[model samples]
Target: MVPISRLTVIAATVVLIDQWSKQYIQGHMLPGMSIPVLDGIFHITYVLNPGAAFGILENQRMLFIAIALVMLGLTAYFLKHIPEPFRLMRLGLSLLAGGAIGNVIDRVQTGHVVDFFDFRIWPVFNVADIAIVTGVGCVIYTLVFSTFPTGNQENQR
Candidate 1:
């Protein structure tokens, strides 16, 4: 399949998993509830986030939506132009788009995003948040390493 096709598949899968996991958490747990799955290292803590990551800019619905739309638009436009050599970047963009969509759905439906994953030391987050973070990490890695002749271009030295 084409790279775009692969990205689409990945993005759709992320959205599906993110949405499903959020629904499961909502159904099984209440807001502010914490379940100790690994003692103090990790926990499933339910939270309704009305802001961006780490609860920044709380209650700025319009800003969140505007940013999401712009990001998605850019992802769609750039995904078509990215060369085949940037497979990891493409994948990252896909995940980012999927995660945005998942969170947007929640925001539109309930005015907040459902979150559950907790690492005790870190802010509570959900699958969509994970996808967005992972996607950004992948993009940064590609920019810093993959595209800089550090991964598969050593033979040129």
Candidate 2:
């Protein structure tokens, strides 16, 4: 079984970093402000998202919060069933939980998520978003590539 301490540490790290970065952005930049990190490529643009990814369902803060909480709960419930030594799965779930909580904090406190890290081609996003997406990708990778030992297999061992 995945160790709860390890999972908690990973999640806490992500939340801390996400919150710190967002706070820094909020203190340093105004909404709609942009600072070029890479000419015409990447930038630090501060924006407040009131809805989900890609700015969809705008102004639906409560709905997004509810969804995130449910997802986090389900992830925790499933994590227990995954066999041990599955580091990637643990990391994935931890990051996912961290990111969700980070955004939830923002929604509860300000009714919006603070986003930065602009790549001119895509909608602006923040550290928490990165963690969430990365976590999901990791989870998908683990599910596709890792083989979990079944009860029968464990019994044989």
**lDDT agreement with native, every candidate:** 0.90, 0.90
Residues 50-93 of candidate 1: C-alpha lDDT, one tens digit per residue: 99888999998878888899999999998998787888888899
* Residue 138 lDDT, candidate 2, scale 0-100: 90
Write down the TM-score of every candidate.
0.90, 0.92
- Measure candidate 2: CA RMSD: 1.9
Clashing pairs in 2: none
**On residues 35-88, what C-alpha lDDT tens digit does candidate 2 reach at each position?**
999989999999999988889999998898899999999988977877677788
